[model samples]
Target: MNLSKFDFTRLKNLLPSSLKSLSINPTSDLIREDENNDTEFYSTPRFVHHIDDRARYVLSQFYTYAIQQTPETITLDLCSSWTSHLPENFIGKVFGLGMNELELKENPSLNQGYTVQDLNQNPSLPKFSSNTFDSVICSVSIDYLIHPLKIFNEVGRILKPNGLFITSFSNRCFPTKVIRKWLYMNELQRVEWVANYFLQTDTYFNPMTIKAYSFFDGNFLPITDEHYVDPMYIVSANKK
Candidate 1:
């Protein structure tokens, strides 16, 4: 089934409620650009920001709102890099897990130490106790997961009761590293796919999606000049 060929616009209009039903069967949908190891792919530390400054600001604002400005909140950043996109006022503990040690170590936001691990090879977060974190965040890096269900389950297990699991992404990604299914879907479907991650696990509730850039644009100064604003989407849910 080449989902890329389907008119998702019509499907969305006809079966809007069924968008969350997009499930990834154990198949080639998980395949990436090559048989090469993901560790090797991410071995080099790329310190560049994937999204624009505006997008980063939007994400940071959303984080502030989601975490409710709680100074005692604890967060786990999965597939983290040099920056967690957390607000400067976010006075909380941040734990980071990423493939590159240099990248993780350089992240000042990670005050609770960091772990270097290739999640594609091992999705389990065994070192983390169950219900340990107030929130688990994956920023701009969810599409590369080959075993997302396992990872999502681990996130659910690590989150405290009523804790939030938030995944944010933009129009940017390493095309070669992103999963095949992700390449086929449009932005709206991708949002639904992330929601489905929570739905399939049956461990999360009150799922919500936020178009950060759009929200900011509508509420703040309207852009009249031609400039590139990276489209950002955040799909989040609360642990049941």
Candidate 2:
């Protein structure tokens, strides 16, 4: 999060005044505003992977190239799901925090380590201590945040200096679960939107670095001789 160019009082002026509605409607709040219903997101266990194998392979490359520096580094997998894709050779304490405890439990690698908390209800991610984790990765979940700038600022607060914050996404998402803000843009614009979330928050990040991996480039391997299509793009940044 870097706030050098974002004046607190002038924040509203930075965004475009016109907003187009390309979505059906905004998704229901992940957090119940009235009575603290934070436990609902964890009520059920869903053993589902969000993206295709091709996209995941791209993410694996990211773990290798972008996170080459992290070994035994305390890590936080934000909006964590069934897996954080930690390399087998990496020995470290990986903390996972997600909405479903069941999903966390299913992640044998996570080893029953996640807490069930709805961030949209409480942007306060109370599971980790400040300056604790060396790296944080949020995979494809930024579109669900009703409030992102605030969340990025908090991400900066909990991360150590020079810590890396990796956020990756594709063109896929549960349209009903994704916030209205995300549906209104094309894929490339979504990358810029994510970058600004860090820029408008605090001063804990270096200039946002963006990367896109191609899933379809005329290379194909068939499983069961069935045709499959993979479309995905990942954008990442570092927390300074």
Candidate 3:
């Protein structure tokens, strides 16, 4: 995609009011924790789901629909874990690229292959050739990326033309690992931030769409009840 042809005005108009006011300082210190080593942070494998059950279900529903919409036979799960949330009937080969080998090995969906690599240290996926995947997904883990734009561009390069790149997140994250921009922004603003990633990278098709699904009674509002449900948000775009 041509960077000059990007319609920033149209993209800005589509964003929420909160996102319009937020600014991204690319030079800022994204990681707040004392430990910068992601390997150490994720050293002990936690065989557990990050989000709640309801949020997982919503994510699964979205993933199922996304896979059905496209001809995705080979999928790459970036920053993946033990569970990929793919539909049981999905007949595709899912590959896992994550920090922990144990987590990737535990994932049943990654029957095709799996690799242990840190995107923060190296954003590029040199192992895979260009246009190797039909779809790329990063579930509930976008906030941890310090070099998100580089990773986004890598996603564009590896995906076939018109292939889908789906990024889903929720209210939960390791506070120290999340970037300052993501940690400071509200849920709506964070949606725009992810959209800006797709736009600024100049790798995705125009008119990036953002969708929010609340775990609280299916309403868009955040869950304020005692049950403590996490609200899910998705920002998706097609490779140009």
Candidate 4:
């Protein structure tokens, strides 16, 4: 997969001009937050999904199918929130870990556990037993995480050797909460950034099987959909 497996065919032209390679931005212009850091950030809970309706449908479709690919057993949704897009009959146990108590409470899908783990200050996740889960799913919140390498490393630590991590995100995000490093990266660079997360941690992620899909597939959702999107990135990396 040495980077080639990341199918950006549908996204080559759409990639933001600002990014074209593995370049790093040492400055914090694009990274700068107009919002004041005085706020505790997640002090208030957001009980809503980030993407529009159309995007949500597409996101749901991905979730429904992803469940089929993996076994019906233990699953972890790190940086998880209320309303995880799991199939009705997933036959697996779903564990959600996020910041908001109200949001997690609203999610009827959470089986028994709802833990909170933030990656900005503490990169280490709470649950640990080494390769314990069959799947690790992160929804549209990947951009919000500052230390992806650390998070991904912890993901690898929790996932069973053959388990997979489904990291998906769209163009929409909370500007201030997202890290400066991610804010500066374009689509292609974003993919590389995520892949490099696995690389940096020396995880067992299989790059050869890595793939990216833009939701712009033939069927476009009505403009009324809640999600905001130009392109999407969904990658599945298997734990070796």
Would you estimate the TM-scores of all the predictions? 0.84, 0.74, 0.83, 0.77
Off by over 4 Å in 1: 1-20, 69-71, 204-226
Name the candidate, 1 or 2, with the larger TM-score value: 1
* lDDT against the true structure, each candidate: 0.77, 0.63, 0.76, 0.66
lDDT computed for candidate 4: 0.66
- Name the runs in model 2 displaced over 4 angstroms: 1-42, 68-71, 208-228
Q: Let me know the TM-score candidate 3 reaches against the reference structure.
A: 0.83
**Rank order by TM-score, top first?**
1, 3, 4, 2
Clash pairs, candidate 2, are 1-202, 2-202
Candidate 2 residues 151-234, lDDT tens each? 887888898877778877877776756766666777667766776666555377665332333334443555335565455555
Q: Model 3 over residues 41-136: C-alpha lDDT tens digits?
A: 898898988888777877776677666333447999999888888876667788999999988888998978899998888899999989888889
Better of 2 and 3 by TM-score: 3
Indicate the residue-level lDDT of 62 in model 4. Answer: 67
